[model samples]
Target chain A: EDQVTQSPEALRLQEGESSSLNCSYTVSGLRGLFWYRQDPGKGPEFLFTLYSAGEEKEKERLKATITKKESFLHITAPKPEDSATYLCAVQKNTGFQKLVFGTGTRLLVSP
Target chain B: EAGVVQSPRYKIIEKKQPVAFWCNPISGHNTLYWYRQNLGQGPELLIRYENEEAVDDSQLPKDRFSAERLKGVDSTLKIQPAELGDSAVYLCASSFGRGSYEQYFGPGTRLTVT
Candidate 1:
């Protein structure tokens, strides 16, 4: 069965602290990996999509990278506003919208 | 363009009561999806539609849950006699079938069943 696991279920950091969240997966084949940021009571906001290993994307203070067995969402100099649960999902080439998701990592940045 | 839209941001009800949620995807998006998210968990796909057709519903609980996407645009999800375990956020998302890897999400409907 396809599976996704994220480490550091919860992380607390002071403002300006940098950290990285990990998402490891085991699937039959890799098509794409997605990253999202979800605030409390709101749906997830799209962050990054990594199609293959060694690929990276950035937005503001967040950087996402993907590899064969895992993906990482790295936050640089994060602020309190950057705090939220980060989600990772994997979609295969089977031509379906089904995405296997990891539980997610809750991040809290305090000033 | 407007993003995905969902109605009833929050709903609180007792067990064995019927509840419904609505969604409107971005114009021109051919794919629509419904997901269930528990607190602290990632959203899980409950159903998916491809131009008014339900392409995936393997995870949906057919015993009490049903969904429809009329005209391939707006959609609705219904739960009959909702159970306490049904308390979760219902999220609606849409993506262009033109191979767009990104899916836009709406503010979810948070359901609390007592």
Candidate 2:
């Protein structure tokens, strides 16, 4: 079975503070790793997709990196607007290519 | 390009009642998906459609839920005799194709079953 686990269920950070959210996964063959940001009462917004172990992608103040068994979403100098629930999902190489998602990490950045 | 569109941003209905939600995927997108998200949890796939055909619906509760996509553009998900446990956010997403990894989502519809 494919499973994903995210650590630090909730995090609080001061403006300009930097922190990292973790996503660990176990799958038969990892096709891709995805990161999404969801605000209260809104659908998740696509952030980045990491395919290989050494791959990394960035957008504005957010950066995502992947490893053989895990992935990290690093928030640099975050702001209040960046506060949202960050979700991690993994896709397998076979089947319908459905995504297996973790519970997610809730982030609160105070200005 | 316009993103996915969903209707009835919020809905509240009594248990055992019927309800429906609609979605219009991005133009030219051939793959559409419906997902349910419980509070404090990630979204779970309910059904997936490639154009007008449903390619995956393994997790859907066929006993109460049904979905349809017509002309490969717009889709609807309906639930008959709703249950209190069905209260959650229904999200619609679309991608260029089944092989596309990135899915753009719409503002979900919040359903409340009392």
Highest TM-score among the candidates is held by which one? 2
lDDT of 1 by residue, A60-108 (tens): 9999998899999999999999989999999887757488889999999
Off by over 4 Å in 2: none
For candidate 1, what TM-score does chain B get against the true chain B?
A: 0.97
Candidate 2 chain A weakest ten by summed lDDT: A91-100
Tens digit per residue, CA lDDT, model 1, B1-114: 787899999999999999999999998999999999988788899998889899889999999999998899999999998999999999999999846778899998999999
Candidate 2 lDDT over residue span A3-106, tens digit each? 99998999999999999999999999989999999999789999999999999999999999999999999999999999999999998889999888999999
**Considering summed lDDT, which 10 consecutive residues are worst modelled in model 2 chain B?**
B97-106
Clashing pairs in 2: none
Worst lDDT 10-window in candidate 1 chain A? A91-100
